[model samples]
Target: MAADVRLSSLKEWDDDQVLSAMSEGNRLALAELYERYWYVLYRVAFQKTKSSEMAEELVQDLFVQLWQKRASLTVRRVDSYLFGALKYSVIDSIKSRIVHEKFQEYQQFFAPQVDSSTEDQLAYSDLLGTIETELLKLPPKTQEVFRMSRFEGQTIPEISQKLALTDKAVEYHLSKALKLLRTQLRDYSFVWLLISFGQL
Candidate 1:
């Protein structure tokens, strides 16, 4: 969005200057800012999430959301803002995963007690529909990585060798896919629990 901004010159600008340019619709400045902080953010996120894929995904998407809200965003200290935002994102991710894990556990516990095959099949179909709809919205590579890792039970190293991507690249895509699906599926997660309890 910038009229004329060289990457070389932007690299020399401080965070305040880069943020100012981003507010003025400078795309290159945003990229420069991302390059500046991505590694440190990744390290911090990795420490908290304890997963390489989750850490990479968090750092990558942090800048994406930052760009989306650049016009209304106000940042006095870029580092503080980035870390604060990441902290909340991490909390939301943790909460969403807990909801999902609880639902899966409920399903396993009640699967043997359910008497109605018709309703069970219907519920599964509805759940699968929600999953597929969200999955299709992701990039093709992300889709492939998620399926290979989850459905096909492939490890990161296997996915990397098979897809000819570096392990980090596979982690990034898998992280993205998992995050997106978890967010979307969050809505239906409690409903699945309700069905398990026969409250529906």
Candidate 2:
């Protein structure tokens, strides 16, 4: 039992040591620290989002953001800092949903002034609907890759492990899938390009 306790303590020190190196701007250390917590962060976000799909994305995005800002990040406790970021990211997602709802309501209020050109509006809406349908029609693995990279914000290596694919394979699949989507939706609007930046 004492040995077990000692082992646990040593495991904790391992995490802290990696974190110390990370704070000193070690990319490899940061990657190790993130991999250690990736699943935990995913679970926390998944619990909040109540969707395995969205949770995966949230975890990915948080780590990407963390990596991008690692040089400036300082934390007294790595676990607490990660969970705090997860909470904030989830809250931000909820707020976005609320804002979207409000915007939809506002649009409904002004429905009378909507463009009366049914042909054009229908065509545009149909195109959007078609794109969404096609996206959903993709293989489950492809969808997961898209969600992890674009929405959750994970790196290629991370996604590769999560889905049990090689990093090179992940990159190829993502590239091909993204190319198809962009080509199909390119004529719609450039705003979808921005959606690739963060979660909706």
Candidate 3:
């Protein structure tokens, strides 16, 4: 009886509970997460993209992809994960439109969470450069997975279908590439800004 009561009480559910529900195709759980973070995500995206329409679009797209990839994703902290994903979405949106100087200003997105040193000019250049450079050093399969997942914005299922591998295998290669980037780019403080939510 108590368990049944708890099951009906979504407001009492933690992130893990919500995610577990999501894994089982629970639309209500997805709605809970969306209601919890969509506004915050939109605000962050708006600050970076400077466009309300763009911000709403990125946040909406993120939720859509989150639903699409829920089974394959290994998210420990939901809010942190959403913020990180939104950062990449904002970058992808602005990547082709902005010059290097304007691009550096995008550091404002991470400035409050990350330190000031990472905002330095050299670090700014290396931040984007390092992502591309380290991306090239991975094994061929890992490289393809990283590009498809990160640069191309494909979900794990999509990559698995395209690459003829299981979703787990695709996730493994994607994780490997990100871990490698995090380790190899540890020197650049800017890299740390993206790799983890908390301290380096």
Cα-based lDDT at residue 189, candidate 1 = 66
lDDT string, candidate 2, 1-200, tens digits: 86455435444567668766666666666667766898888888887888888788778777776776667877778889889988877876665454455445534543344656777567656765765776787777887887666555565655765788887888776776676686677665443453333332
Q: Tens digits of per-residue lDDT for model 1 on 65-100?
A: 788779999898999999998886676555444545
User: lDDT tens digits, residues 33-140, model 3?
Assistant: 898899989899999989999799889989988998888999879888999988876775665234333334545653345444645655556566777788788899
Clashes of each: 0, 5, 0
Among all candidates shown, the one with the greatest TM-score = 1
CA-lDDT, candidates in order:
0.74, 0.67, 0.72
Q: Can you list the residue pairs that collide in candidate 3?
A: none
lDDT value for candidate 3?
0.72
| Residue clash pairs of candidate 2 | 57-152, 60-152, 60-153, 61-152, 61-153
TM-score of 2: 0.47
Q: Weakest 10 consecutive residues, lDDT, candidate 1?
A: 191-200
Report the error of model 1 at residue 13, Å.
Answer: 1.0
Model 1 misplaced regions, further than 4 Å:
1-5, 113-200
Instruction: Please say which candidate is ahead in lDDT: 1 or 3.
Output: 1
**Cand. 1 TM to true fold:** 0.56
Residue 48, candidate 1: Cα error in Å is: 1.3
